[model samples]
Target: MFVAAEIKKNTYYDSVYLMRITKEIEKTEGVIDVLVGMGTELNKELVSSLSMMTKEIESLGPNDFFVVAKIKREEIMGVVTKKIDSLMNEKKKNNVKEHSPATLDSALKYNPEINFALISLPGEYAIEEAKKALEKNLHVMLFSDNISVEKEIELKLFAKQKGLLMMGPDCGTAIINGIPLAFANEVSRGNIGIISASGTGAQEVSVLIDKLGSGISQLIGTGGRDLKDEIGGITMIQAIEALEKDENTKIIVLISKPPSENVAEKIFKMLNNSKKNYVVNFIGSESKNVSNSKTHFAYSLEETAKMAVELANKSTVRNKEVDAKCKKAIEELKAKEKEAIASAKNMVGNLSVQRKYMRGLFTGGTLALEAMNILRGRGMEVYSNLAGDERFILSNANDSYRNACVDLGDDVFTRGRPHPMIEPSIRNERLIKEIRDEDVLVILMDCVLGYGSHENPAGEIANTLNLAKKDMTNEENDSPIIVVSIIGTNKDPQNLKESIIDLENAGAIVVFSTAQATRIVAEITKSIGEC
Candidate 1:
């Protein structure tokens, strides 16, 4: 199907040689591939000259053709033909546009109303651009990580003073007037409003409500630091106050990983005093469920959404059964500690949990903080990621925490490898290894599903879990129990449901929200024993 020819003339440039080869091939029949080689009869210099010219000839067409210099004639022929075919196939796959950094920057000038600048540039250039956007009175949605929390707070304060919304220094998702923006889910709108300190927390809440055939009045992302000691819910408090004053909003949702007791108290006080209905989902903390009118306490995102939806419809909370069932689930978890530890990593949302007492690795900052919060709230001693310590410390864990209602877009995680949404194969081994020891019990994660998610995340999870099960069994132990808060649509991709079934079969109890998942696992682990 292909032919190789040796060109010996000194006048032959690769381009000319290719041209000659094509003409020759045209004269021949049944030849699909063409390769030109310079044999021993040709001088090395002439062969070298022909090499450059051959590319032009191939571009014109030979079915596929290649010319190589310096290498042996047969070797050159093989290399050229293979390269040509590969190049052709590559062209067919993705017509990637290669542009210099300057070209990309120039293109930015075209989008003016994009007042909210979301900078995901490397840290070196992000601050300067943020300053530029701020100077231009543009709202900023910062997706840049590695920027210091201090810088983030300063920028947020500056934006606030300027009467503009500055979403994040590591903000990955948001919603505007019920429309899913950035790394967000497609959900409709209603009277419910949200302010989240965790990037995906707001996304999960808003999207869940949206999927339930409702919508949001507003969803403001407070970055992850809004509830931290330094920030103290500055933006969140203001946003809640504003939403409370707005006539369109009937229900409000507060979603965060977890906050300090002092910060939590302030927020609780604010919500307790609000005239509008409010639902709170602090990922790992189980504060007193608000008993009076106008406010409700939800341990999970799904519960919060369910309550919000009910409030929108002027209905009261009628799910005492769900809470009781969740409590019973926690007891079942307590009975399965060793088995859970064998197959998965441990996670904590609160910071008061004794990291040293546990022998597992952690992944979510908020979840870790909540675990610590739970322990401290219950009058137990705990350690935190602060003090710049070597062990039990991480800065950006929430960035990777799985929230079913958010999509972090195809940015950092999707560039060159498999995204978390697509099944984290690379992340699985680490998860299994970290949890394989005798002290770990829980694998905490937020599972989000929607248009941009993997079709079979649950199925993929099950497969990974099955592999982990084999690993655990080989080590003479049972698989770890996985507690997941799954956020997505019953109407999402068909595989989403299948994935849930797969995860269930693989021994994961997948719930409806990260907050709920965290609460269930925490109560379950404490009851069962250290999972």
Candidate 2:
């Protein structure tokens, strides 16, 4: 075997593009492994771990682009380098054909009517660009994460003063003016408007609403930090005010992780005064009744969508009638829960006692949190990399503990690399490792589809899942149950039906919602405990 390294000083490409190139290069004959990325510390470490790092790579700075590969022979090094060059040329040709602008000024000059800026950059460099966009009176959706809380507050306050919507520094999903942006789905247009701090949470609800024959008016995302006490839900408050005044939006749905008490109270007070009906899902928060007759508190994303759809369908109804609809929705959810538990029992046949733990490898952080919360609610002590409680935090984000749901999209896993959502293959290695663990009874995952997410995400992981199942069969070990929840719609670019067929064909038990998938895992765990 031989190692080949190439460093291009001052050359840079989008992380997602680099990841795609890496995937394509890896398919070349005689190529053992490859890492293609900017020379960030994390990427260097990753190359070292793969035993492909060299002194030249070590000397490259963050601004430099590098490719390190382990190959079968020296001759294959030429083949690999040519592949990388061809891919880079292909991107350049596409860029030329598209006539893409290189800067905000040029973009505005190209189209003066633009009112929205979707910024995705490294956090260190994102704030200035965001500030520039806000200064231009543009609505900004900042996709970059890792920005300081202080910087976030500064940007939000500026946008608020200007009466502009500042969606996120880390926001990933939104559907504005009937167009899907960033990581969002294509659902029908209707009377329900969603404001969420959780990206995947919003996607789950939006898709579910569509599945229930309802649709979305708008889906606004307030980057995850907007609801923190320090931020005081600035973007969320602005979103609510905008929705309240929107004639098209009659039912408002809010989704987020439980917020700080003061922030929650602020939100509650606003909801109390709203003339339109609302559904609130402070995911994993204790169930509590709101003082307002028009408000419904939901415990899950599914419930949030159901209640919103119910209210939208019965907009003319008042207090008692609305309450009755919500009650019926909750009852329907309970029935589904019971059915999930029954299905879980039948699926856990002849399982060995040693296979006792549930392991979740997720690309969506919010989805991971929801699963952890469900498992914890059911008396399981779930550990996670995204855990708010230190007691449940994983000591090493790379390794899973007794009952773990890991958000592989977390910064620890994504630094200097493309997000798992953009490159689903990032989770493949971890899934294989988990499948080999004898203690893992069940594996839970999510396949998020839409613009800006990987195309055919389910197909990317199917081979890994299939090989694992085959190996388990050959060894006569009960294969760990694999549960996948797809958060998408039929209208998405990635055909939803085909994605499900790929997973099902690979021996995965595929569900439509994250809540149901986690509940199924929780039920399977409960059965194991009883045994």
Candidate 3:
């Protein structure tokens, strides 16, 4: 193997753009892997981890732009470099033809009508940029992660004082006034408003609501850390207040991992005081009754969306009628579960005794957590990087233990690469690795489609899935059953129907909801006596 490095002193590009360039350059025939970024400490560590680090890379300052590639031949280095240069030139040409402002101040100056800023810089620089936007009386959505909790609290409080929405330090999804923003799906505009701390969690529910023949009014995102003890659900509380007064919102939905007990109490009090009916799904939380008549608790994202749709369609009816509708929704969900179990039984005929473990490679962290919770609830000893219980946490995230589910979108996997959402190909290697493992019985995943997500997520993995399955068959090992849940709508940039067709053609069992996919995997594991 050959490793090549190139440095451009003082040159800078946003991480997203760099990731895009990296993805494009990696398509070169001889390239095995690539990293493109500014020379930050984290980037240096990432290069080292990939064994692509060099003395030149070690000497680079943070301002220096670098591209490093591992390739099959030394001659391929020129091809990789030329590809990088071509991509950079293409971006520059596009920028020249468009009104691409380099900084927030310049952007606001060029267009004073801009009232919202989506900040996606490195964490060290994002806080200041977000504060500047908030000071300019603009709503802020901080897309960068690696931010400290203290910084998040500070930003949320300042935005609150300014009476502007501060969405996240790592917030990834939102739809405002019918426009989809980073990692969000397009749905009909209606009366259901959402405030979610989980990006893909929100996407799943919104897509499900659209599928159920209902729609959304607004979808607000509070970054995942907002509900912790220190931050105390600052952004969530503000979002709830906004939705409460929103005339178009007749039903509200809240999604998150279980909040701190104190934070949960505060959120419940606000929900109780609101006039609109609400459903709360703290994904993975035990479903329990709340004191408010208008409040409903859901155990899963599917149930949350269904209950919200029920309330939205029957908002004018009396409490008794609404109760009856919710009960019917629950009954319907139970019926679907029975069908899923039956389907799993039929599918398990292909499984061999060696096929006893389930491996989940998820791009969505929230979705990954939900899968782990569901599997554990079904009495499966699931290990994961996102596992909340120490005993269930995987010691090495890159290696799968018995019945392991990994969130590939976690920072560990995304340090110097695009999010699996942005570059669905990031999960390709991991997917193939799991496929080659003979002990794996089931492989579960999510295809999240939306405005800012990969154009054809399912297509991106289809070839890998095809090749891996063929290899397993050639080796005479039973290929693990691949189950995928697509979180998308027909209106998304990616054609939902085509995406589903591609996965099915690639031999994956395509489902619509993440919960349904998890349930199917659990049933298969149970049939094999592994759970």
| Winner by TM-score | 3
In candidate 3, stretches whose alpha carbon ends up further than 4 angstroms from where it belongs are 1-3, 29-33, 48-59, 70-75, 287-289, 316-343, 473-477
RMSD of 3: 3.2
TM-scores vs. true structure, each candidate:
0.58, 0.90, 0.92
lDDT of 3 by residue, 283-332 (tens): 88765536888999988888889899888878755556545655665676
Query: For model 1, how does the per-residue alpha-carbon lDDT over 58-173 read when each residue is reduced to its tens digit?
Result: 33321232343333234445554455456446654765676424432453566555566667664546877887788778877776666787777778788778877777776666
| Ranked candidates, highest TM-score first | 3, 2, 1
Between candidates 1 and 2, the TM-score winner: 2
Q: Assess each prediction's global lDDT (C-alpha) against the native.
A: 0.56, 0.87, 0.87
- Tens digits of per-residue lDDT for model 2, 1-531: 999887789997777888888888889999887889888787788888888889999988878998888889999988888888898888878775566887888989999999999989878778999999999889999998889999999999999999999999899999998999999999989889999999999999998888776789999999998899999999999999999999999999999998988899899999888899999998888745369989998887877888888888888455575456556656675676576567557668766678889999999888898888888888899889996889989999999999999999988888666788888766998999998888888899999999989888989878888877776654465767888888888999999999988988887878777888988898888877731
Pairs in steric clash, model 2? none
* Candidate 3 TM-score versus the reference: 0.92
Mark the 10 consecutive residues where model 3 has the least summed lDDT: 317-326
TM for candidate 1 is: 0.58
